[model samples]
Structures are given as C-alpha cells and as structure tokens.
Target chain A: MDFNIFLETSISIAIAACISCMIKICTVTLNMKSKLDSDYFILKNKLILAKKENSILVNKVVLCNEINSKLLQSFFEVVKQLLSLQKFIFEKGQ
Target chain B: MKKKLLSFAFLFLTSFCFSQDHSKIIDSLKTVIFKKPSDSIKIKAYGDLCWYYRTESIDSAFKYGNLALKLSKETSNQVGEAQAYNDIGILHYNLADYKKALKYYDASLKIRSVLKDTMGIAALYSKIGLIHQNTFKLDSAIFYATKALKIYEEKNHTRYIAYIKSNIANIYRGLKQYQKALETHLEIADVNKSINDNLGLTRTYNNIANAYLFLKDTVQSEAYYLKSIDLALKYNYKKELAGLYNNYGGILHDMKKYLEAIDYNTKSLKLREELKDSYGITSTSLHLAGLYLDLGDFNKARNYLYEGLNLSKSFNINELKMDAYDKLASYYAFKRIPDSVLYYRQLFKSINDTIYNSRITKEIAEVQEKYNSAEREKEIQTQRAEIAEKELKLNRKNTQIIGLVTLALLLFLLGYLLYNQQKLRNKQLQKESELRQALVEIETHNKLQEQRLRISRDLHDNIGAQLTFIISSIENLQYGFKITNNKLKGKLTDISAFTKETINELRDTIWAMNKNEITLEDLQARISNFIDKANISASNSNFRFNMDEALSKELVFTSVRGMNIYRIIQEAVNNAIKYADASNIEIHIKKKYEAVVFTISDNGIGFDINEIEAGNGLSNMKKRANDMDATIIYKSQIRKGTKIILSV
Candidate 1:
C-alpha cells in the first residue's frame, strides 16, 4: 500500500510537470502575441510619420517643379532673343 | 509669406499665453479655436488649454485633453495624441487620482515609444516615477527615474536630466538612504544651475534639505532650506515655496521652537491655499494646529484643527483627519473643559479606528484581488484536467465493457462445447455397456449349448450301443438255440424290434438336442431317409416322398420345432406301413399360406379313424404336432384306401 501511494505520488508529479510545461508554452505564445502587437503599433506609427513626411516632400517637389518650369521658360525667352539678335547681325553683315 | 507670418504670430501668442493666469489662457485658447485656425494650430491650442487647466480644474482638463485627442486622430497627428495623453495623465496626477494617472501615463508611454518621441518619453517616465514615489514604491520609482535619466543624458537634455535626478533623490530619501539622496540632490542642483532652471534648482535644494533633516544634521538642513527659499522666492516658485515652508516648520516643531513652528506652518498653509494645493493644505493645517495646541492657545488650536479637519474631509485624506482629531483632543484637555475633552477624545478614537480599518481593508482588498486572479487561473486548469480525466475514464469504461462481453461470450461457448462433449460421451458409454452385455449373453448361451450337445451325444452313443447289443443278443439267441416253441421265438423277435425302434428314437433325440437351430432342408433329408428305411422294411410296399419346390432354402426351425415335426412325419409313415398294411405309400410336404401341409396315402386295407381308438403312436404324433404350434388331421378310409393328412 505504501508502494502504491509512492507510485501515485510520482505519477501525479509527472502529470503536474506536463501540465506546467504546456501552460508555460501557452503563456509564451500569448507573450509573443503581445510583442507582435507592440511591434504592429510601432510600425503603424512609423508608417503614419512616413506618410506625413512623404506629403511634405511631395509638396516641396511640386513647388520645385513649378520653379523649374518657370526657369525653363525664362531661359527659352533669353535664348530666342539672342538667336534673333544673332540672325539680325549676320544678315546685316552679309 | 502670410503663412510664415501667421505661424510666427501663433508662436508669439502661445508664448504670451503661457505666462498668463489659467482663466485667461483658457479664454485665449478658446478664441484661437473659435477663429477656425488650421487643424494643426487648433490641436496645439487644445493641448495647451488642457495643460493650463490641469491643476485648476480636472474636468475641464480632461475635456480639452479628449478634444485634443479626437482632433489629433482626425488629423492623424501622432505627436498631438501623445501630448494629449500626457496632459490628461498630469491632470489626474495633480488631482491625486494616481490609478487613473498611471493608466493614462501608460497609454502616453506606448504612443511616445511608437512615435520615437524621446523627450516626451523621458518626461512621461519622470511623471510615472513620481506616481510610484507617491505610492511608496521606491524600487519602481528608482527604475523609472533611472530610465528617464538615461534617455535625457543621451539626448544632452541637461534640464530634464537634472529633474529626473532630483526625483531619484526623493526616492532614495524615501528609502532612508540620506547620504545617497543628498549626494544625488547636490549633483542635480549643479546641473539645474548650469541650465539656469531656477525652479528645478529650488526643488533640488528642498530635497537636499529634507535629506539633511533625515540625517539629523540641523545646521545643514537649515542652510539648505534657506538656499532653497532664496531660489524659490526669486523664481516665484509657489509649489516649491509651500513645500519648503512645510519642511522647515516640521524641523522647528521637532526642535521645540513652538512659535517659529506655528508661524512657518501658517505661512505654508496660506501659500498652499493660494495655490489650491489641497493635499498641502491638509498637511500644513494639521502641523499648525498641533503647534498652537502645544503653545497652550486653545482657540487658535481649535480653529486650525477644525480647518484641517474640513480640508481633510474635502480631500478625503484620512491621515490628516486622524492628526487633526488627535490635536483637538489634546487642546480640549489643556483647556480643562472635561466634557469637550471627552467628546474630542471619543471623536479621536473613532477617526483613528476608521483610518486604521480603512488602511487594513485596502491592504486586504489588494491581497484578495491578487489571490482571486490566481484562483481563477487555477480553476481553469482544474477544469481542463477534469475534462481529460473524464474522457480517459469513459474510454476505460468502454474497454472494460468490451472485455466483459468478450469474456462472457467465450465462457458461454466453452460451456456449450463442454455440455455437448459430455452428452456424446454418455451415449458412447451406454452403447459400449449394451454391447458388452450382448457379448456376455452370447458367450453364456454358446457354453450352455456346448454342454447340452456333449450330454446328448454321450447319451446317443451309449444308449444306441446298449440297444444294439440287446437286439443282437436276442437275434443270436433265437438263431443259435433253434427253439421248437413258436411263442418263445416271437417274444425274442419282438424284443429285438423294440430295441431297434428305441435306438432310432434315441438317434432322433440326439439330433434335436445337440443343435441350436435346424433348416427345413435338414428336416426334409431326415424325413426322406426315414421313408427309404420304411420302404426297405416293408418288402411288399413302396414309399414316395414329395416336397414343395417353393419352400425357401433359407427357412429354418428351432431344435424343438424340427424335432417335433420330424417325429410327426415319421409316425405317420410308420402307421401307414404298419397298421394300414399298405402295398404302396406316398408322403407330401407342402406350404399353404404360413403353414406346412403333410399328407400320407396308402393302397391297402383301411380303417375309419373314428372307429379306432387312438393308440400311443397316433397320440404321440398329435402331441408332437401341438408342440410345434401346428394343427394336425388324421384321415382314414375303408375299402378304397387310407389317407392321413397333417396341416401345420
């Protein structure tokens, strides 16, 4: 009877250990979910900041495009005037 | 150009708003929002409004904080949301709603971590540290303060670093590490001075003073207190001034300077009231009341005690109320007002008991909450185990049922087989016993027949020889003597014939007794021989024997029946030859239905069977036929012929 009790105690301890191991595994899985949530939120914030930065950059690019167009038109006007003056001087010299 | 000017104007206005009173700043922020400024500008205004209202009105602060949060979410402003959460946390902290403060702070911390807002994160860390410090969690306070300090130091934010260091020093002081607390405070003071943070410097100095007081160095404490006072007054640091005055009053109270203690305590209370520091008011009120009570000014003590009591009730501060009650009891006793003293004493007892019970209850509730959470988890585990155990038990039961059924079937089959085997064995044994009995009976009958045959053969051999001898002697006597007398010769001849007849009968008896059964063929052969003999004896007569061809060769008769039938046939033939004096005789044996018919006829002198009395020969023949279970008839005729018929 004493031996039977000892065997029962040993088996109970083994089962408890197995249960504890499974519980630990589940807890680790839950902790991983929490970590992933944290990472997701962090990435989301980063994405939002990136979007804001992108918007600012887009605005600057549009402004620069306008400036570039204006500068090209001015350069073309100057070139047309120079070409005409050169043509007039060449014709008069001829 | 207009946008830049507007932004500049907004910054100027915001800077101006920070220096104004709470109501004015709130009004300015309202106007800014009313003007339909850009969403960003409006969000900023809301955030500022929340911070300004935090100490003055918690509800208004929460309202604006929520507005800021909503606007920021609408605009997708992560930084604005983080600032809103921080402002709300501060408001709760100032209102002494530490639990709500911690929750909001944690929310802010998460956002700030997400936004990578280092400065905001550091500032939140310090605030959280202060909450922990207030709750007497020194280890947690130190942890958070150290985290903030590390970040601030990395960013080269000297002012923030100094502020965090000062908080850490306060925790160290709470832990009773006065030397470490004083060293950290002194170091933070240098950093605060370097950054020209007069408010931070003053706070650091006040912390150092408290540390010195804890160390029992009154001179150093007094010097540090004076330095902190100078900086606090110069910078108009109302909060720090109130705290410094309270601490200085406590030191004076401890030093037995009653008047000084009362004056300092009163100043601290007035400043706390002006600043709306409800917690500070309760503390300084109790101190002033107790000091006045010690000075024997009953009215002043009573007034201050009542003020402290009312403030403690308003703020729900039990420690302050407990102190106020105690001081009131002492004051009434000093005045020799017995009834008033007793009343105050009872009041003091009641309040003390209430505070003690509330503390104990709060502690128990916290422990119970933890225990309940653990029990809930354990209950879930136990339920899972129980389900598994039940499943196992169910499976075991099913297996046991199957095992029991199989065992029963096997037992039933075995029982049936055994019963069938036993029945077969009993039948076999009964047959063997019957066979053995039959064999024994056959053996006994064979032995008895052998004994009977031996006895009959011996009698035939011996009796036949003796009869033959008698006949021979009689014949010899008659021949050899040649007797002249006729009667003597006749007698000798009769004796020889009689002996011859007896020998024939003896032979017949031996034939019948020696065999168990006889065939009809044997009887016929015996009867045919008798007829031949009769023919020879009667020289003037001829004999004929007839048998049915249809009589089966396999037909048999028992010994007794054969003997009886043979004798009946022999007697009939003899009677015909002897009595009838027949010239020729015929005998016939025929089957008629299941019976045999025997007939003999003679052509000789005949007599009527009715006229003649039955002699021994005829009677013996009839008797022999009866023993064979056969019917016999004798017939005779005169003149024409004599015919005898026997039917059996």
Candidate 2:
C-alpha cells in the first residue's frame, strides 16, 4: 500500500510538472511577445527622433547657407562700389 | 609712363621670380583666365594668381587681386570677392602702403563679417590694427586690436590669441607705453611656453626686446634680442630672423657702431633677398644706404639708396617710398643736387598728406561694429548647439525610463504567474491526498463486512447441526422404548417437532448470512423440498407446487428479504397441510407487476377465516409477509377448497 501511494504520488507529480511546464511555456511566449512589442515601439520612436533630428539639421544648414549667401551678396555690392571709386581716384590721379 | 608699364609687366610675371613650376602654373592660369568662357573659372584663376604671388611679389599680387575682384563682381561670386579683397590688402600691406592696405582690409572685413566667418573677421581685425599702428593712429589701432582680441577669446583659439596679443604689444610699443607693451608680450610668451609654439615664442622675445630697447634698458634688450635670435635660428624662423636683424641693426646704429650696423643691415638685406621679401629688401636697403652715408662711403651709399628707390617705385609702397625719398633727398643735398632734392621732398610731402586722412579711421570704426554683430550671431549658434544636445540627452533619458518601467512590470507579472502556478500545484496535491484517504476508508469497511458474514455463517452451521441431533435422538428413544403413557409420548413428539422447526429456521439464517444476495430459485428450491417432506409424512393427501414461466429463471433479492419471502411461503404450505383435510393441495408462484405472487389452495373442508381465532401459523405468515413487505390473503368455506395467496 505504501508502495502504491508512492507510485501514485510520483505519477501525480509528473502530471503536475507537465502542466506547470505547459503554463510556463505559455507565460514565456507571452513575455517574449510583449518584450518584442515594447522594443519595437521604442525603436520606432527612436527612428522618428533620428529622422526629426536629421531634418532639423538639414533645415538649419540650408538656412545658414542662405543667410551667408545674402551677406556675401551685400558685401560684394559694397566691394564693387569701392573698387569703382578707387578706379575714379586712380584715373583722376593720372 | 614707362615706369608704370614696366611695373605692370613685372606684376604679371611675379611667379617667374619664385619657383619655376609655379610660374608654369601661373602661365596656365593666365591663359585660362583670358580664354575660359566661364566667368566663375576666370574669377577662380584670378584668385589663384593673387594667392600664389601674395608672398613672392607684392605688385603681381596686387594686379591679380584687382583682376579677381573685378571678375568676382561681374560674376557675382561673393566668396571670390572676399578672398580677392583680403589678398589685395595683404599685398599692399607688404608693399608698405598703410593707407591703401587699410582700405582693402576694411572691404574684406565687411564681407567676412556679413558671412559670420569668425576666424576670417578676427584675422581682418588684426590686419586693420596693424595698418593703423603703421600710420601712427594709436587710439584707432587699439580699438581694432581689441575687437579682434574679443573674438579670439570667445572662440578659445589659443594660438591665434597669442598672435593677436603680439600685435597688440607692438601697438603698445608704438604708443611708447613700455609697461603695457612688456606686460602684453609676457602674456604672449607664457601662452607660447605652455603650448610649445616656438615660432610664437621667438616673435614674443623680439617684441620684448623692442620694448626693453625703447625703455633704455640696453642690458635687458640685448639679452632678449639674443634669446630671440637663438630661437629663430634653431627653429629656422627665417621671416622672424630677417625682422630681428633689422631691429638689432637699428639698436647698433643708435649706439654709433656704424660699421657693425652696416654689417647687420647688409645681413638682413641678404636674407630678405633670399626670401624674396621685396618690402624687407627695400626697407633694409634704405637702412644700409643711410649707414654707408654716415660712414662716408658716398658711392656705395648712392648705390643702396637708388636701388631702394627703384624697388619702392615698382611696388608702389608708400612707407618704403617715404624712407627712400628722405635718404635720397639727404644724399642729393650732400652731393649739391638741389633740384633732385626738392622734387623728392615734394613727393614725400604729397604722399604723407594723402595717407593721413581721417576717413580711414571712420572706416576702421565701422568695420569694428560689423564684427561685433557677427560675434553675437556666432554666440547664438553656440547656444543653439547646446540646446540641441540637451534635448537629445533628454530624449535618451526618457527612453531609458520607459525601458526600465517595462522591465519592472514584466518582472512583476512573471512573479505573479509563478506564484499562481505554485498555488495550483499545492491544491492538486491536497486533493490527491484526500482521494488516497477515502480509498483507505473504503477498503477498511469492506474487510469488516467480510468478517461479519463469516461469523454469521459459522454460528448458523453449528446451531443447525445441534438442533438436528436433538430431534433425531428424541425419535430414536420414542421408537425403541415403546412407551404406554399417551400424554408423555405426545409431549415428547411435540418437542422433537419443535427441534426440527428450529433446525429449518437455522438453515434459512445460514443461507441468508452466507451470501450477500439470494435468488428466487433458491427460495423455490427450499419450498419444493419442504413439500416433498410433507408428502412423505402425510401420504393420504397430495400436494403439487406450480411456478410461472417468468419465475423459471432466478429472480434476485437481498439476503434478508429472500429469507423473509421463503419463510412466508413455507408457513403457508404448512398451514394448508396440517389444518385442511383435503384430497389435493396446490401452490402456484407467478410474477405480477414486478412482485412475486404465491397462491396455496387445498380441496377439503375448511373453517371460515372470520369464525376462528387467528392461528399461530397464519399470524406468523402475515408477520413474515410484513417483514418482506409483501401481502397475504386467505379464504375458506365448509365442504369447499381453502386457498391462501401471497404477493411480494
């Protein structure tokens, strides 16, 4: 009788272990899926930020270059007038 | 007119005086500049020439700078224009025309400031300051120098700071503020010492020597000059060496060591010639000429002075022209050529009046204001970069916080699931243990039930055998002795009959106890055996037992209920046999509505059931029917058959 009880206990434990393993497998699969979803969302957000930064940098560069272009234009205008004046001075001196 | 045309030719071929390969490059550029259909390329070629000739030949550098500037304006190439102006300014500065140098420098400074080119603006500030210092405009020089200093300080450009500081020190020396000049030079020397900038250190030493010389500290001046010379030679700072030799020669001249001064000036001139520093050659030649004049060598003196004059005229350098004119006027006077002396004197005065205009000071002030605004713009850019970096860090921190929270929640959920699983496992174990206990209790009850049946069977068997023996011994005594007493014999016979009945009751108990259940067939078989014995004992009457076809097979009953049903049938049969005087007796068994029906009838004279008291046999049969939960009926008539029916 004791042996029978031991055998029954062993079988029960085996069955319980199988059930536990199945539950563990389900939990693990759910955890993995959740982790993947979390990581995917985080990465997607990071990609968006990177794209935003890239666009911002490009805009800033364009703006800077545009301003420089305008500045250079004004500077050259002044230089042209100065050169013409110098030419008149040289001609008068001759 | 011939001199102007010759100067133009020399400016165009300045590369020829430098590297032969560079001359080829310049030739190609000149061809491209004239022939290329693209105005942009023409401008670039012009700019290239200006850059190549800036150091080698000042007049060529000026011509190219002007050409590039003109083409850049035609093409609207602002970068080329800015570069051309800067190059032209440097060329004129080298040519010793401080007024023209400041004009070109301001133009370049305006463009660079508008472009927010911080380094370029700072460099232009230094150049403009140098021009002002050259013209002896001390206050205007300090303003531009300080403007450049602020920009370099904001940019943290250490090397450029030291260079600008050296220039400021030179300006201080020109102001005769010896204390301020020495302090600025020391500051520059400390920076150079920290960064190991040997070239900057050599220049600082030279400035310190000049400062000491102006203060009349000859010992300190000579020691610093030697230090400057030693470093310049070791590092091969040829440009600094040339300037140092000229300055040292001036000190020698002040000391009235005319031969030594001439030797140093000649050495300086040789180095300038080797370096192709046309401005240095002109200035040093003028110095050598004056030294020879002081020493009474008129032929050598005129040779040096005229060479200096011709070179200065070719380059259009006003500073060198002024010095050459002064020396020539003195020489011509010494030689008694009054007409040449008056012409050179008038020329010097005309150039001086042209260079000293205050419009130049106003322009320098305007350029300084432009640089200040550009500096503010650069500061805004730095602030924007810092804000962007902070935002990026904040974004990273937010992501880290979200990741950590997700991890913590996941861990919590995992822990909850594990805890639930453990609880379920413990509950299942408890249920299994309870099931095991129930099975043990059931097994124990089954064993006790089996023991009870065995004891009942043993008691029934032993009691039945003893009762049978008593009946048989009573019969044997009655037959063998032949007793004559009727009452005693009758009583003995009654006792034997009682023992036989007791034996039958014991057998029924044993049968019911030995089996958990008894079949209707066993009850039927026992009834038939009693009928057979009754026929043998009472041969005068006939008895017949009949059963229905449904009762041919065994009908099941519980052991206790079967015994009760059998006893009821046996009593009915016995009562019919003893009380009825009939020729025939019949007992019939049938199944009716799931109950067993038994009928016993005798063909004989019978007493009325209502007239007689209830007999022990009849009452016992009713009691046994009640025990079996069955029904019994009896009917009899005078000279008619009697019948009893039992249904269970």
| Residues forming the 10-long window of minimal summed lDDT in candidate 1 chain B | B448-457
Candidate 1 lDDT, B134-244, residue by residue in tens: 987677898999999999999988888788888888887888888999998988888888888888888888888888889999989989998998998887777789889
DockQ of each: 0.00, 0.00
Deviating ranges (above 4 Å) for candidate 2: A1-94, B1-49, B59-77, B274-279, B309-648
Clashing pairs in 1: none
- TM, every model: 0.47, 0.40
Estimate, for each residue in B1-648, the C-alpha lDDT of model 2 and write its tens digit: 544544445445554534455557677667655544366556666777887765456578778889889988887887788888988888777767677778888898888878888889889998888888877777878898899999999999999899988888898788778989999898999999999999999999999998999889877888888899899999777778999989889888888899888888888888888767888998899999999888889899999999998998897777788888888889888889999899889877777766554356656766787787788788888889999988977876675555556555655666666666566555545554555454455445445544544444454455455556656766787888886667557656666665555555555555555555567787788778878888887788898988988665568766656666777767766666777777798888898887788888888878788888987888978887786677888888877978888888
lDDT at A91, model 2? 75
In candidate 2, clashing pairs total 0
Point to the candidate with the largest TM-score: 1
Compared with the true structure, the alpha-carbon lDDT of candidate 1 equals: 0.75
| Two-chain DockQ for model 1 | 0.00
